[model samples]
Structures are given as structure tokens and as C-alpha cells.
Target: MTTMTTRTVAYPADGLTMVGHLALPAGTDRRPAVLLGPEGMGLSDVERRRADALAELGYVALAFDLHGGRYLSDPEEMLARCVPLLSDPDRMRGIGHAALDVLRAEPRTDPDRIAAVGYGTGGAIGLELGRDGVNLRAIGTVNATITGRPGEAARIRCPVWAGVGSEDPIMSPAQRNAFTAEMQAAGVDWRLTVYGGALHAFHHPPVDHPTVPGVGHHPQHARRAWRDVVDLLAECLPVTEDQSEVQGRLLTEPR
Candidate 1:
């Protein structure tokens, strides 16, 4: 196993003290990095583990905060917080950029090689960063098929990969169509995956607390979607020998 390190990082964004989890691969050499965004619930263990997993693959990964360190178990509270944040593009970009700055500030991060992978609300924020013209190597999102202003989307310079549950009422078929159309009209390199029989937040593991209606977990598709995200990062942000070895191990490891 590759040796790695983890820590909590606090930063300011939108007048909130955002707390992010940072994972660093073991080495002196600079490595490619990823800015991970979590679902609307906030920066939970799931996103933290994902950051650690990415670090084990030799990438510096930071799982950013969405609700300033609070995890909302109440569906109504989650929506109440997220619905408004999602409506404001600038707020989303502010949050993402703050985390991006933190990622880039790490000594192990290769400033030029970075990507964004997010789930649910975090996914939408990642897209916002891309639309804001952040120089990301790639953008991968799950359960967030939110559309953006075409004028801003046209500024995106990276490829986008989005995964959504086909039965997700929140991200309905019409929403997906609108999102795809915007991406297409903007001349972006984009792809969409619809997991059959899954619902909103299908990529997440089962939660202890009750979730909102239309939200459920699909373990099989969740693993597959994560694999696709790994593929995207590998294709766009090539790592060094040490990292590549770990990456090989990660790819072949049994679930």
C-alpha cells in the first residue's frame, strides 16, 4: 500500500468558514490533483474516504465542504440550503474556487494538472467551476445534471462526464436533455450516463438517516461510476511512476 497523509483544512468562502479534508500521496515529487465535492448532505465520511482513495492512487485530493462542516440529516434542511445555493452560479463558483485554491496551494500538487469530481450538489459546484472558466483537466459529476448559462458554459475548456440515475425525479429526463443541449451548443466535450432503475444520489452508499423521496443507493452502479471517474482522471491527468503503480493496483483490486 502507498503511504499517505490526511488533514483538515479550513478556509473562507461566501462568508462561511468552510472545512475541507485534504489527502496527500507520499512523495516529494509533485503529482496531479483532484478537487472532490460531496453530496448536499455536506463533507461526510464518504467524500473523505474518496479523497483518501484518490491519495492512495498518488493524487493529492481535497474533499471540500458544502455546508461549512455541517451534515444535514434532514431532507428539508438539505434542500433548503442547497436549492438556493444551486440557483446562484456565482456562489457555487466561489465555493469551488476557494477549494481549488487550497488544492493548488499544496506543495505536492502539480499546479497545471487538476480535475474536479463531485456528487449531487458538489457535482453542480464542479460544473460551475468549469463554466466559470477554471482550467480543469476534466470534470466528472454524479447525480447533478444541472444546466448552466450557455454563455458561461462556453468558457469551459475541459471535458465533462456526468452520471445520473434514470429514475431520478430531481434530475428528470427533461433536465438531462437541457443539460446535454447546453453542453452541445457550447461545443464542449461531454458525455452522460444514465443508470437504469437507480434514483437520485444512487452513487452514494446507504445512509443511516432517512433520505428525501426519490433518493436511494445503487451499489453496483455506484462502483461502476467510480471506475469511470478513475478512467477520466487517468486519461486527463497522467501521474508519475510511483502513482501509476498504485493506480494499477487500484484498478485491479476486487470490490
Candidate 2:
């Protein structure tokens, strides 16, 4: 059985109230926690599914909200709400910082193993935490940008894995290459995975089933990317019970 909790956090200092879905491993063991930030479309079903999947991996994952529960169907409306934050840069940093603080404060989370992951705009926010020198174990981001480049480059204290689509027009390959150069120069333990033939948000593979729109999902790539993420977590966070079983099977079963 999995443990799931729904909670809301109010950052009065920032005038942002966020709703989060916290999922934990079964039983009383305090698990490593992950904070998930959603894309410009807000916290959607795909994100929740990802969070649940993280729980299945035996971590407490909090899919935190960034839009204050205000979602927009029209692209313009979504931009209307998001553009301000994107423009200022500091707003996203503050939003991510507040949510991270709240997630770590939870009793069921292992504060030392806490990490952050995000999609699209949310991924950028996750990177901001790295730039803020939050001392997380690892960070995962998909289809996001690297703004304030060298300025924030020195702040990342964790391994960063960035999943990108080779075909994504928004965050182009040239940009990724440039960003990689910056990351390398800064001595960041980072991996930039460019999925061949994939498009933006390609991890939203289930989006085709009457689910969220504009979320491009790729099953094979999604699984691969998730495995990569899980591997990163295993390295950075404390191990879990299920992971022990899996390792046992691998060594004893002899392939």
C-alpha cells in the first residue's frame, strides 16, 4: 500500500498559496522527498502521475503548485499569468524556494535527501534552487531553460540531469550546447540527455489518452528518462526497502 497526502501551503510572505500532492512509501519510515514543479500549464494530471510514480519508487514526492490554482486554457491566458514570473526571474526563484521549504518541513520527509524536479518552466525553477545553493542531493529538469547563465552557474551544489528533446524548437540544441558549456565550466556534475526525434515535453506520453493537451509523451523515452532519474535518486538520496529487494534479485537471480 502507498501513502498519499494532499496538503496546501500558503506563502503569505510571497502572496502565493500552493496546493501539493505528497506521496510516501508504505509505513512509518521517513523517506527521501522530491519536490515537483509543474509546467506553464500548471499542475496537471501528467505531473501527478509522475509524482505517484516517484512514490512507487519509494520516495515522498510533493507535486507542488506554482500558479496559485489558476489554470488557463488559452495559451495567452497561461502566458498572462506566467509571463510576469518568467520576466522577473526572481519570482520563480522565490516561488521554488518557498515550496521547497514547506516540503522539507514535513515530518515524513528526509530533509537531507531532499531534491527537486520540474517540467518546462518548473524545471527552470528547479535549476534556480541549484543556483541558490540549496545543497540538495540531485536535481532533475525536463525541457527547461538556463537563464542568468554564468551568474547562477556557481551556485549549483548537486548533480543536475537535464532531459531535452533534440527536436524541441523552443529550447534548441544550440542553446543546450551553450548551456552545457556553461555547466562544464562551472564544474557542475551534470548530464544533458537529448532524446533523438523527441519533441518538447515528450515525457508526457500518456497525454494522448483524453488527458492534458500540449504535453508530448513518449513511452520508451519516458521509461528511460525515469530510470535515469531513479538512478540519480539512488545515488543522491538514502536507499529504500524496495530498492534493496531489487538489488537482491539482480545479484542472486543471475540475469
Candidate 3:
């Protein structure tokens, strides 16, 4: 594991206090920075682990909190907070932009190497950033709801890797098929990974609670999905040097 650093960033914009964790790869003068958005439930321990993993791989990972330090148990309450941001593209943009600014400003991060990755509603936020021209090199979305996303999807010039479960009820086969076709037509360098036999929240295995009001977890997909994240980031946002280890490794992976 690389030497990692974690910090909580409180941004004055939108009166939201977002907690962020930065992890750096060993011997890296300035590493790529990634803005990671948490699921609708808020920032969980699993996300923290993901940040640590990203840091280990040599990127400054910022696991952003959308709930502003408050978490809700009921799904309705969670929706209340998340729905607004999803409904209004402007609000989500502000949050994502602020977090991106924080990540880019870090002295240990390279400004040109910034990416955004998100899960669930956060996935929509990542897409919003792509549409707003966040100037990101890449994007990764896990179990995302792609409603109202077609318009913006076409505007995303950056490469996108979106992962959804085969059994995801929220985003049915029809939706997925349509989205895939749309991205293809839009001329966006896009890739979709569908985890077979996986359901919503398929990446959170250690999290299990009946009243949690969220999807069940799957460990296998979690591991595979994270591997994809590392692989994609290395491909999309490489360092300035001409050397390309990341590209070489990605070429080895089966497309």
C-alpha cells in the first residue's frame, strides 16, 4: 500500500460541508486526482476503503460526501436530499465542481489529470459534470440511474466507463439497451460493464441490513469493478511523461 493522506474539506459553496479523503501513490511527485462521489446513502466505510485503494494505485482520490454530514435511514428521506440534486442539474454541477476544484488545487495533484467516478445518484452527478464540460479526462459510473441523461450523454466528450448489474431493477434491460445505443450514436468513447447475476449495490458486500433500504451487496463484482476503475483511469488520465505503463496494461485487458 502507498503512503496515504486523508482530510475533511468543508466548502463554503452551497453551504455544504463535504468530507474528502486524499491518498497518494508512493514516490509520486504529483499524481492524478479523482473525484469519487458516494452513493445516495452517504459516505460509508466501503468508500473510504476505495479511496485508500485508489491512493495505493498512485491517484489522489477524493471521496466526496453529498449529504453534507447528515445521513438518513429511510429511503424516502434519502430521496428527498438526492432527488433535488438529480432533478436540478445546476445544483449537482456546483457540488461536483467544488469537489473537483478541491482535488485539482491539491499541490500533490496534477491539474490535467482529473477524473470523476460516482455510484447511483452520484453517477448522474458525474454525467452532469461531463455534460457541463468539466474538462475531465474520464468518468466511471456504478449502478447508476441514467434517466434524463440522454441529452447530456451526447455532450460528454471524455471517455466513460459505466457499470450496471444484469439484475438491476432500477435500470432495466430496456433502459440499458437504449443508453448503450445512445452513447454509441453520440460518438462518445463509452464502454459499459454489466455484472452478471448482480443486483443494485452489487459492490457493497460487507454492508447488510434489512432496514437499510438499499440494494444487497456482491463482493466479486466489487473487486472486478474497482479493477476496472484503476485500469480506466490509467488509460484516460496518464501523467505528462511519454512513458505509458497504464496504457500498456489496459491493452492487455480483454475489451
lDDT of each: 0.92, 0.76, 0.77
Which candidate gets the maximum lDDT versus the true structure?
A: 1
Model 3 C-alpha lDDT per residue in residues 1-255, reported as the tens digit of each score: 546667766664457777665666666498778888888877777677888788876678888777776555567788788777777888888888887888888888888878989988777788788888778899899977474454666778799899988888877888888877777877889899999988887886544434233376788888898888877887787644443664776478687
Candidate 3 TM-score, true structure as reference: 0.88
- What tens-digit string does per-residue lDDT give for candidate 2 at 122-183? 88888888887887888888888565446677789999999988788777878888878888
**Over the stretch 1-255, how does candidate 1's per-residue lDDT look in tens digits?**
548999999999978899999999987789899999999999999999999999988899999998878899998999999999999999999999999999999999998999999998999999999999899999999989999975788988999999999999999999999999999999999999999999999888898997989999899999999999988888677677665577678778597
Which candidate has the top score in TM-score? 1
lDDT of 2 at 30: 82
Residue 159's lDDT within candidate 3 is: 95
Poorest 10 consecutive residues by lDDT, candidate 3: 205-214
Best-to-worst ranking by lDDT? 1, 3, 2
Q: Where does candidate 2 clash, by residue pair?
A: 204-217, 205-217
Spell out the clash pairs found in candidate 1.
none
What candidate 2 gets wrong by more than 4 Å, as runs, is: 1-14, 205-215, 241-255
